[model samples]
Target: MAKHPSLQTSKHQRFWKNRRVFLTGHTGFKGAWLSLWLISVGAKVTGYALKAPTEPNLFELLELRKDMISIVADIRDLGRLKAEMKKAKPDIVIHMAAQPIVRRSYKNPPETYETNVMGTVNLFEAVRACKSVRVVLNITTDKVYENKEIDKAYKESESLGGYDPYSASKACSEIVTASYRHSFFNPNEYGKHKVAVASARAGNVIGGGDWASDRLVPDCVRAVLRGKKIEIRNPGATRPWQYVLDPLNGYLLLCERLYKNGAKFAGAWNIGPDLKDCKSVGWIARKFCDYWGSSKTCSIQKGKHPHEAHFLKLDNLKAKKQLGWYPKWDINEALSKVVEWTKAYESGLGVREISEKQIRDFEGFPQLNDAELY
Candidate 1:
């Protein structure tokens, strides 16, 4: 991936610099990355989420608690979340806190609905009351779309449906976002200060520091590191895979556009790699093993595995034409970078330094000075 020329000239830099933002779920994999990136750009971020789920999750590994006002609370706790947002009085809000898994959802359907659906509702209610918030972005998943096993990529206008609890919860969250946007923050009624809302659907993201269970990349990494054969649930399932930062960049870009032009860009946008980059689980595992040079092998899990979509992809034309957003890294580079970070950290190198280096590489920023971050 080529460096994204310095944002020094783009309004994205100035817009993000020193901005007061409320970020829920900063303890999760993608949230940790977003929090770190926001801090790097000088955003004053207040993170609200429960403690890391796993012992060695990215949030704890990177020590993200030091950089922001880390609020260790569940999003379902409306009173606590509301008070935090009120006190923070953020200029923007990004809701990412949720139960983000498919098979896990089947295992714990009620918990998934409570977090993904009710949690989103609570966040939107809080945002509605927080007058200081000018723009909001609710992060959903590509699974929010109703899948029919068609070969074509899904567009934003497609019907919203999900066969699994996790996907359905996210689809419900999307509805809640749209309902709140139109019912509460509609520019035609409440005007711009009411807070513009946009939802983003991202692809299957893989990167370092993600140790979540039931995920392909993390499972591969763990098995490789442990000299165990990785288990593949759906080897033939094809997904639009991209580096975690790719969709994150799109989210930031979406926020910028919504902040600048209220209703013009206020809607759902898809963030994913091109269709050709989409690959099967077996293919991804082989590539990861090749990059790590670990002799780990992957075989389809025996017995029952939860149902997952066989093929899924997102059409990103809307975001590209409207927000001028495009994926920076291809699959090869994305996987290589992930392996690079995992290997470096596993080798007893400074994890934080390696993470920051990858971040700099992704954003095209110059290597950080010693004083910036270690």
Candidate 2:
């Protein structure tokens, strides 16, 4: 593999400075981190999403509304979405709003499809109306692949399939991105439209400030805080785990490439950790327990749960070779950071300061230990 430069590399800063970015789902975990990163790099961000999905969410934790234009709305509302896009007149669009939980999808499949599939359609429709938009990056999951429960990692060219409603909905979302790319933002006609469209598929991302349900790290955090054992539903299932900033770095790098090269960079790409980091649920739980330095531990939750893939991973060679993006933090470093931030929050220390420091550290820049923002 080729050596890749650190994120926020000098050239990237030049590209992102003063750039207009329209980001959906900025209230969510990954979105909040990306929103903060964008702001730190000098991007003018307009965030559109429902209110923070979880109480004590990162959006409110960071007080992000004070930093950007935040619009509280549903992704399915085409008219409202279009009006907002028109108003923002953004140069780049990043679609992240969706019904992201897998178990929740099994409970309400209709809402899942409506939000993940049709919401994607509505975003493209809004993009069609907004002429200022030159790039659109839709974030999807690594589960979009047709999981045969094998050890092989999935590539961007592999067949798209999903056994669960959430996975299936994201597969449909990927198809929607492809349709838009071919029909509206066709690379062959780059001269005519001057718009580029791409979709990013990333593996399970763990970090601080995620309060979402049914996830490994959040479950561990909650259990540890309460001095209870962490519940492991599927102890043996393995996933390509990387820190949150690793994949977000890839997203920003891809966006920059798509903006400058246009057609050449338009398509689906996978951003994930190295194969060695694909750890089982039990392994992650145990490691996280060790990092927390608490008496709390892991306990297998015995119950018939809805079906989920036993083994999942992504082939990140394309991103590494083409975009010069690489996963910076391994599972160990990731879990340590999560524990560090969670403990700081529990001790009533400054979270925004810790979060910013993490970003700076990840970018190979100077850590802003005293750079406090509320």
Candidate 3:
């Protein structure tokens, strides 16, 4: 949490000011952003995850080791995770580590299940032992829903199914979270164990400090940097694209509500952009190129690629009506921020400073259009 003028104050400041958080996958894109935001909000964070998936990472860029107790370990190692949990005695736990790439999951299904499913079990086992933790938010993906290839948005109560190995593993993760809640941490038996657990499903989160492969935003950044024509796969497929911080805000708010009111806030949630912003990949690439000052149009990749959802959106009415969560930035604005970040990176600006400023900008709630990007 590098200091910026805008991140100086948060609405939930009183709740998270001194809370201790045990965060998994802090080395990755969303993890790094969440860790920084927590620090900015005056929270103590202990990051537990494997070595960063990418070379140039946000964790190193922001020097997060100074703010958090960065631990390099595997989530699959239950003994090690339990020891760390006991040592840290965190007040809250956010599980974000997983084999997140769909293509990679296809390449190695066993690894995905081992890391996503068994790894979830290992986390709950650790939670069972460490009573210091009161709230646990397991971060899953929008792909947990069974895609019917229609324009209909999926709700939290919808049937849980997955088309790909990655999606299936995450669906399993959700099931594991539910089982732990019903079996061990039942709210009716709140007197026995005072822990509340919930799972969060988010749309396509785009933000700064992401340099992963097979992701649309990072792919666009790399193409622009290398002067290559942006490549588009399944251009007609639509997705619920949103800025990363939007979902992060939902997660934090949910944690705050759960801390004060236990069982009522504990359940599955969806943090997605407005329905109008759910646009096709071609629209995203086109908007991104316009923002990045690239005249080169997107070149649609020919031939068969891995199967992906032709239409995917999330019914965020639950989070909106329940948690009062809404996306501050829309799709076009999200793409513009991505361009701004890339420009800053190319100009050799201190990314820590720029990232902090972006967080502040979102906090300021700058004006953005509600129209569909298409």
Candidate 4:
């Protein structure tokens, strides 16, 4: 496959410098990482989302609010969201705010649908009214695709389906994005609107400073720190796990391409790890346990858990072919970084510096010279 240049490649460095970016969900794990990346590359960023969802979050660890125009608000507040966004007058918009937890979604289905579905509707509506915005990349999840419970990887062309509330809500968000794209921001009418919209679906992303509940990595980290056993649910279930920075790089690349090529780059794309990186949950737990050097252990939690896909993966061939994006670090490398970040946080050793250094390191990795299709 043709590999895209490393993120923040010298070719794209100047483009991101002083780039005005309006990013939603900056307090979340992926958003915090993306915010740091943007700041590293010299982007003027504005972050809007509910205050960091967790007590100890990447946002506060990095003191990200000092770097961007941080707004503590809900995405469902359309009038307030539109007003704040209009005031920011951003050149690019990345919508990432949503009720992201699958388990939490089951307990609060109404909130999930309202935020993920209608929140998307509000974002597009806001973007449509904003003349300064050129590109909008809505971040969804790999769960948006229908799960036939097979070992096959899903492509963007696959039908959208989800059994769980979080998954189904994200599917609805995808449909909403398509409707808005073809109806209001159609590529054919680019000359009139000058706005291009795209969405990204990524697999399980594990990294540091995620104190959110019910996630494997964070649960393990918190559990280890507290000297408790990590609870493992669905250990046999497999996932396409990549470092948080891996897909964040793809998101930045998508925004860059959409900014330059317009409709040619506007659509749903999967930013997932390579086929070899797709590991079972049990394997990931073992790897993390080994790397963490912890006497702490795990036990499979037996209970009636909400339904989750047993074997889920994304066919990232389109991203590799069209955008030259590639996963820089494999699952082990990703786990190592997670260990590094967790240690930094646990030891209280410059968490922000460590996180930023990792981002810098990722951008300097050996990049593919040209695009190759597998």
- Per-model TM-score, in order, reads 0.93, 0.95, 0.96, 0.95
Q: Relative to the true structure, how large is the alpha-carbon lDDT of every model?
A: 0.86, 0.91, 0.90, 0.88
Candidate no. 3 TM-score: 0.96
Q: Clashes in each model (backbone N, CA, C under 3 Å)?
A: 0, 0, 0, 5
* lDDT (C-alpha) at residue 90 in model 1: 96
Q: For model 2, which pairs clash?
A: none
Clashing pairs in 4: 1-372, 2-371, 2-372, 2-373, 4-324
Q: The CA-based lDDT of model 3 is what?
A: 0.90
* lDDT of each residue in 47-90, candidate 1, tens digit only: 99988777688888877777789999999999998999999999
Better of 2 and 3 by TM-score: 3
| Candidate 2 lDDT by residue in tens digits, 258-356 | 999999999999999888899999999999988988767678988789999999989998888788777878899899999999998999988788888
What is the Cα root-mean-square deviation between model 4 and the actual structure? 4.1
Off by over 4 Å in 3: 1-6, 366-374
lDDT of 2: 0.91
The whole-model C-alpha lDDT of candidate 4 against the native structure comes to 0.88
